[model samples]
Target: MIGDSNRKMQQIPPLKSIQAFEQVARFGNVAKAAEQLNLTPSAVSHQIANLEALIGRALFVREARGMSLTPAGEQYQREISGILQSLALATERAGSAVGFDCLRLHAAPSFGLLWLLPRLDHFRSCHPEIQINLSCSYETLHFGRHQIDVDIRHGYPDWPSLEVRTIRHERATVLASPSLLERIPVSQPSDLLGQNLILSEAALVQWPQWFAQQGVALPQAPFALGFDRSYMSLEAARHGFGFALESSLLSQDYVKRGDLVPVFPAELSTPVSAHHLVFPRGHAEMSRVRHFLEWVQGQLGHVFNY
Candidate 1:
């Protein structure tokens, strides 16, 4: 590349000349190439003329209306076009590697608002380089038309060919405000018989399923409160309205602040593999995806006691 006489004879053309030649060959007009390259038409034509002189071959056939590529120019264009595209792609990737990387994330509504959003400050503070685009919706796990890099789902998804890791394992137990417990004392699971039970209508694991797992025959009495979303049910339980069976992981901040307390013993608590981080297989291999996955794993790897 530096000193060999044979290599010196094969000197590479100036990048600008090659750029102008490619644009003109594709557009078949000096003015369009000049506009695209943000250079004067005369400048573009000068670059092309210089390139033709250096190559010892006329690259374009001059015409009254517009130019057309010669046989040599057609061959050169075919070769150089792919190289230019590759160069552009490489430049974009290099820029992203430095700091401009963005991660597109989608999460379930309640988990996004009540759990993930609360802890994003810590993640951002550490990795200021990575930008996160967070979206939340109740209808998740379907990547159909959305361009999501990662999905924060709840429960064991049977989605084949997807990389699913359970980020947070939780203890699903009775959660109630201190005032509510003081009003109706519950020493055993059977004591919840006639008590106000706040139910999450769309929850995967509901009170009926909890009782079925506990081998407790539930009464046919109507629930005291019903909500389709967990946040609302949790909020209602925090107001001393009724007992809400919720995951300890999602209600961690509330438990830490003593807004809600576990009403049942640890033995009665059901282990749920909840709060999964799902993505297409091998997606975590990317630096941006890996950063998020590693951050989440590090944050939730420890057990939070009730």
Candidate 2:
């Protein structure tokens, strides 16, 4: 009975020691494993030493080249790796079975309202099983704090520490209410000079940029009403308050309904503001992430022409 008890005790490793050694062995560097495991290099080294002592064997040979696993260590490493992989797979399967495959989506408020919200039903139809939690705000999101699975942003596509995919391009155009258009006949871009201009604080330079693109000198400080958000500016324009520079994509529904009219027959177009889909760099291998990205790419169709 004592012999059996001793054998059982020998078969089981000190779990903390074994875990540290496995990480170090798999990475082939104590420092690298320590970083990944959120432990110090010294701590990892100490754990490895304790493991070697418990097993009554030296697992690694420290050399000028680097640490190398001994033959016995290599054998033990293979077994440990198999065990870890099995545990990971089992955990993943259990999580999935419990409907824990959730995706945290972050998006800018105006873009979410005008563009993404309209098309999100399609994504829902495609990924009915994947729960998506969307956090919409006007400010830039901190991906680490929000634990965001994906971020949809409208900008230059140069976000740090993220994998970026250009989902769509954007163009800007002047939109005015049909009532305002009826009152003042605007046949060309220059005709906008006499109209009350509505401006979005977020896109203050949009009109100036559009005028520059058309090679038309903007009237110095035209009478304008300014709002903090694009959606509010668009709302003001819809109510016949004034003309506003709006995304061709977002203005299409109103334009088609004759609620809004474009200032010029030839719409002022710009190099598409790259609407990007971003995610954490290291999560590219996750199956759910891969699937969602593929779906997003497939759904990207040019919904506007100006």
Candidate 3:
């Protein structure tokens, strides 16, 4: 019995190999997986090879187009993915248990940078006993599978089986640098027709919606500069590139700093959507999660009157 147990333990693959395989399985491209793991393509291939040897199965089917998981690979992924995440959480908790509490939080890229990051110092000062591991991504993660404590998502509250709350009402408003607005006068929504509009890919409200709300007509195929994230749009607005439609709450800091100013005197805000705090059901009972949730709500409410 002792010899059998020793042999079984020796068969286990290295953690690095498993991590590399998991990333490759999810991404379906070694280069993409390598980028995520900060490893080279050859190194990722080596790890995958090592893992396959340990399991005695081909984990991935290499193809001309891209890689696809084999049946065994898929089965292995489904079994081990959640386990790996749980292991990570356990490891983090072990460290926290020794000293301070730990909270694993995720947020959308722009919101993390423009909004949450600015106020994290305040949270740290208030909750000195808790350690926060904050991650930013545009892709929606499986809250339970990824073991995320809280996710700050910008969209309708439609995530099934999750406790969702509207943390901040995202008011879409037109903003531009004071210098830019001065050079190209924009007294009314219609005045913005001929001006360069900085478009954000993540914008919940578009130019047409804003124009329609103001009872103004939109030009067909209007010329505009596009960015993938809100932070980029805000930066463009600051540099006097063009007017951008974004969250009033997100732009508040910029507005206060005089980097950007509201386009219209009337606070024309779009009511299409808002920011929601999402977590797995029953997680609100956790002290760390609840504390952060309440604190963020108060902070955002003060910033944007949500």
Candidate 4:
């Protein structure tokens, strides 16, 4: 009698068929569900049919326009949605524990260069069980389609449907080689007029913007040099090329090592700009994403507030 009961339980619909029904219910169309599942429409329809046969009832009402869930299908979906979510979470946790999970992180190029890459060694050392893959890009990446677990971007809070955490509030200041400072002393913003002004695309506030913020109009266009990255401008400044306005957080290491000296005592606080970590709305709870987020927050605790 127990064996018969076990055999009957084994006759339940496959998980894939249930998944197909769920996706179809979500999109209300086989084609759209197929696209998400990476299967053909016919396959999605076939799966739903198989599922319906197992339940001894039609799950979806076939229509000329598309498909709609039957009342039974809607009820089933309501019940199974939470089950699938829990199963997925459990599977992810298991995969991460077994070292089979790979966390993908995307970051702005400048942040990746000056901030994340420098500190990733400690993260890797502590969490040797988890693997990390990092990609740097200037373009905005969406969390869902891009499969990005975390994205570190330099911007204000504007992205929608993503969890945004401010990693650092940026303040820009003029920095230069000590030797260059010896040649040209800056007492006020106006004194920067004749000096070489290095501008970087990656800067939260550039030379022009910083000067304007300081309430000093450049009497003349200073001899300007432009670089595509903030690090490049800092490198040029280290070689005594010119003065560069840089974020204090990015220049902390250089300042400590005496590679760059502040040309001015004044700092231009950027009220509307900051470094933020973004994640898909629901992904933050996943073990892999949660681990990385906690590690990063801990590493930058001094620099960032929750």
Candidate 5:
């Protein structure tokens, strides 16, 4: 059994190409990397090319003064850097083989609690060493004071210095429990007006907005119940109290799990985009933040403009 296991073990790889790739990523210049490694610029470039070929992905965006890492290259560089660091410290810095990275992520309460919290384990499964410090609230993040690595914000993207990417390309629709639907049917858009409509003070798109899309006029009366957060509204709706107008992206699990259902056909739904990934220019360069963002990009089904 021991002999078989040893025979199945993969052969040791050539570390020269990996080193060359890391050096180029570090300096963003073949000449500078070659200078440090005591090799010609051509040799450094050749080694990186071999590494890229072996991995089957371009690692750099070649430019005039230097080369910049591509998105894939950035992630690869981060992983390779950690491994190389571990190898270097193996003999000298015992028990400190792998590097630990921490990501401080802040997000809207509903998204954090209902959506991200459930899926986070998948990220942990892939990157067990990456530590995540997550905070959820409706208030805007104070980047400097909070020391947030990145944030997920809902509503319009209007920060002055921060960059924004729309994380959810989704629809705004009326959702209700089967029991609630049985009590008050919603065959048309105006039918929701008669039912107990849930109100969320923190919602990016409200009942009025959703009704307006269907050319239905909403009344000035109060809702059956109101809440300060979207999660509460969704939970109330899921319990059959009333219908809720929410993002298809945020309410996906509820609908899938049979806790809630879309009241209208998809044709009646309105295209609404609210959730966004927000970060400073320099923060995107950090390995931990970049890694999280990349993983987030993979979580959503539709991730472009709505």
Candidate 6:
């Protein structure tokens, strides 16, 4: 019994030493393993020496050409490789099951606030088991860092190494506070010449574009107040600060509440922009990602026309 206990103690290598030895064995070169594991070659060699001492055997036979594993070392390497591979596989499977591994979603801040937030409850209701992390930025994502799984972009479809799906077409119209419209008489697009304009930096060109489509010359009297986000710009319009060109889908809630009113009738509409769902190329087959894309499409479809 005492002999068996002593032997068991000798068989266990120090944790760090075991890890270093595993890297060396897997890479089949001490220098390469050191680089891969972010350790010095000397440190790797020291760990291997300690591991050899613990096992009471020469694991590798040093030669003029390169080091080679001994008969015993080959056997140990096979066993250790299987154990490590199993551990890695188990961790990956567990992470996928819990959905806590990582799933990154990138979206424009205004759109996320206006459209996505309202419908997120339905997604959470359906995918209660999955954990979702969101990244809100105005700029495009760098997928090289593996930081994003999906991106919702507003523009013409052009992204490298991505599968694009058009979610909705952008249709914008002038909206103003009910109080502002009540105080001032506004019966046509030309009536906006007297009112203040709240311009969003993102859509600074939208009003001009829409006006050109209507064949109405740009107004030159009242200056426009500019804001960074559409939601804030809309808020300014809602507070009677100024009139803003807002997407119908985003302003639907306020319009329904009678807080804001559309400036022009539907017949005077023009093509503004388009929203798209972008995913990494070749990863479109992922089940969870597909589920999210489909859910967004269904929700946005119900809210926006096309």
Top lDDT: which candidate number?
Answer: 3
lDDT ranking, high to low: 3, 1, 5, 4, 6, 2
58, model 3: CA deviation in Å? 33
| Cα error, candidate 4, residue 184 (Å) | 1.8
Candidate 2: residue 201 Cα off by (Å)? 2.2
Over 1-306, each residue of candidate 4 has an lDDT whose tens digit, in order, gives 999999899777787887788778767899998998899999998998888888888888889988888888877775554345456546666766455667788988878888788888898888776688899987886343455778888766775335688866557778899999888877787887877888877666666676677798854764578888777888898999988877777777788899998876644444435688876556677787888888877876653443
Model 4 residue 198 lDDT score: 85
Candidate 5 lDDT over 80-196, as tens digits, reads 434543444233335444675667789998889888999999999988888888999878854533567678888888754456778655777788999988888668887766678
Model 3 lowest lDDT segment of ten:
297-306
* Candidate 5 overall lDDT versus native: 0.78
Q: Write the per-residue lDDT of candidate 2 for residues 57-145, one digit (tens) a residue.
A: 89998876567889878767645543443345446558676755766778877777876777778877887877777888756654433
| TM-score leader | 3
Quote the lDDT for 205 in model 6.
46
Give candidate 6's whole-model lDDT. Answer: 0.72
Better of 5 and 6 by TM-score: 5
Could you tell me which residue pairs clash in candidate 5?
A: none
**Model 6, span 51-169: residue lDDT tens:** 88878899988776567788888777645543433344346557675545344678888877887877777887888766677877778864433356678777677653356776555
Report the CA-based lDDT of candidate 1 relative to the real structure: 0.80
Each candidate's lDDT (Cα)? 0.80, 0.71, 0.80, 0.76, 0.78, 0.72
TM-scores for all candidates: the values are 0.66, 0.63, 0.68, 0.67, 0.65, 0.65
Candidate 1 off by > 4 Å: 1-98, 141-145, 302-306
How do the residues 188-253 of candidate 1 rate in per-residue lDDT, one tens digit apiece?
878899889999875667898899888889868999999987899999999999999988877889
